[model samples]
Target: MFSRLANVFKGIFSLFIKDMERKNPEALLELEQENLRKQIANFNQGLAAHAGLAERLMSQVRKQETEERELHARTTAHLRAGNKSAAAQNALRLQSLARELEENRRQLAQAEETYQNLTKAREVAVNAARSKIEALKGAINDMRMKTAMAEMNEMAAGMVSTIGGSGDTLSRLHEMVEEERTKAAGRARMARDSMDMSEVNIKEAEMDALADQALAEFAAKEGIALPGAEASVAPEANRSMGSNPQSESQ
Candidate 1:
């Protein structure tokens, strides 16, 4: 039971960590990059050690070659001197040096091959890691941009919904402003109607009377016959004739 509980807790922790890694991929990428660097460093150290071994093998081969040459020269010198024992001893040593030289050459070749393989492997690994890192960077940037766009879309949708809703602030403000404008217009009309207009009416009537008198005088001066003027003059002439019987008799 305890082991089961521990497994459950471990699973929960792992899920939590995975969630964090997903949410913060850049951090994960950095961690992977650091790991790559460490791997490379370790790889380089191993390469250096291998190179040292190759160098040692090269040195040994050179030493064996030099010994073989010296021993052969000695063997020839001893044979010229007719010292058979000395010559045979030098020849035997030369044979051993030759064999060691061949073995050293073989080992050197193997070391070189190993070193080249390791270098190539390290290069391949580094390249693969760098490529993956770059890809992750691009993915993270795309995800960020997509997230921002999604958020903006959501905000815009919410705003649109809010604006069309009855409880929208701007809509309420518009309604309030329209109502105020209507009220103001009604109030203005009421104020205009309530104001005193007796003086204005009297002044207008007087102006009309003056305008009519002026029109009559202008018509008389210009000798322009008006429709009512002839009737009025004929009546006046009749009255004058009645008042003056002498002129009427003449």
Candidate 2:
């Protein structure tokens, strides 16, 4: 029972972690990138150690080669000096050195090949990981942009639905404005129709007569005959002449 409960708790924890990873993919990607860096550092350290081994092997091979040459010269010199025992011993030592040099050379070759292969493997793995990280970054950005656009579209759709619905605030406002405008126009028409024009016309005519009298007096004082005065005087003069003839005849 305890084991089962522990398993259940572990499962819950795993689920929570997975959910967090899903929600914050960039964080997870950064974590992976950091892990990749650490792995690369460790791998490089190991590669350095391997390179050091190869260098040691190379040094050993070179040293053995030099020793082999020196022994050969010593053996030849001993034979020329008629010391058979010294020559034989030097020849035997040279043979052993040759064998050891050959083995070191082979080991060096193998180590060099192994180092190259390891370097290539590291490059391939790191490149693959970096490419995946970049791809994920692009995908995450695209997702965020798409999500924002979707939210905006949904908000716009909601606004359109609300504004276009009947009996909404804008519709009521429009109706109220039209009703008030019609009422105002009706009131104006009624006011215009209720006005009495007879009194106003009489007053207007009196003002016009007063203005004409003032103009005529001004023209007489200035000794400038008005056109209206000339017309009236000519008609009066003709009437008087006709009356004089009548009176003479009578």
Candidate 3:
């Protein structure tokens, strides 16, 4: 069972590696990244607008404050002219200017407060994208790995797809995985045979030759390597018995 799972993992992993190398799914990764960037851009624009408004409001307050100071100065000059009626009128105008300036100052203060709050919000929004970007990258990598493994299976003797009349994808995936596993197991057996042959301290010349040459020479003199021992025929039948995950899940 573990062998079967190992095979499946290998098959799946190959697809992922291929995708990563090829950057085959660039569209998917780009689309997600673009979405996050757009949101951040929108937030920045709002913050910029808010800051601009605050600046404009402060400028208005400065102008009104200056006007209020000038109106008071003029009213004092009228009082010193010994014109009581004119002085009274000037004083009333000065009071109105003062009130307008005070109101403008209040508005400027509120605008500044709002701008500060927006600055903080903008920081928070931009900071939030860091985690989102990382997550998107990881998701893309994972998808790439799967796509690569699938392609590898196609290149190998394994079935790349099960889109045929009666078969399905999951079954085909398992078949491919098992096929790969058997090939691996065959290589393992050959390595073991070579190790055993090396231990006997056979003639250095004999060992120098390829294993195939030594095996052939021994076969002619005596039955050496088992029949078809060189054949890397994997146990396709054993793996054929396993069910495909796609079907199992269904």
Task: Pick out the ten consecutive residues of candidate 1 with the lowest summed lDDT.
Answer: 241-250
TM-scores across all candidates?
Answer: 0.75, 0.79, 0.46
Instruction: Please provide, for model 3 over 27-49, each residue's C-alpha lDDT reduced to its tens digit, 9 standing for 90 to 100.
Output: 65576678878987887888788
Candidate 1 vs candidate 3: the TM-score winner is 1
**Model 1, residue 216: what's the lDDT?**
94
The runs of at least 3 residues in candidate 2 whose Cα sits more than 4 Å from the true structure, single-residue gaps closed, are 1-12, 193-206, 222-250
Better of 2 and 3 by lDDT: 2
Better of 1 and 2 by TM-score: 2
Residue 103, model 2: Cα distance from true site in angstroms: 1.2
- After superposition, which runs of candidate 1 have C-alpha atoms over 4 Å from their true positions? 186-250
Residue 36 shift from truth in candidate 2, angstroms: 1.0
Arrange candidates by TM-score, highest first: which order?
2, 1, 3
Write one digit per residue (lDDT tens) for candidate 2, span 1-250: 9999999999999999999998898899899999999999999999999999999999999899889989999999999999999999999999988989999999999999999999999999999999999999999999989989999999999999998889689988998999999999999999989988898999999999999999999999999999889999999999999899889999
Model 3 vs. true fold: TM = 0.46
Q: Write the per-residue lDDT of candidate 1 for residues 18-38, one digit (tens) a residue.
A: 999999998988988898889
Clashes of 1: 0
Quote the lDDT for 171 in model 2.
Answer: 83
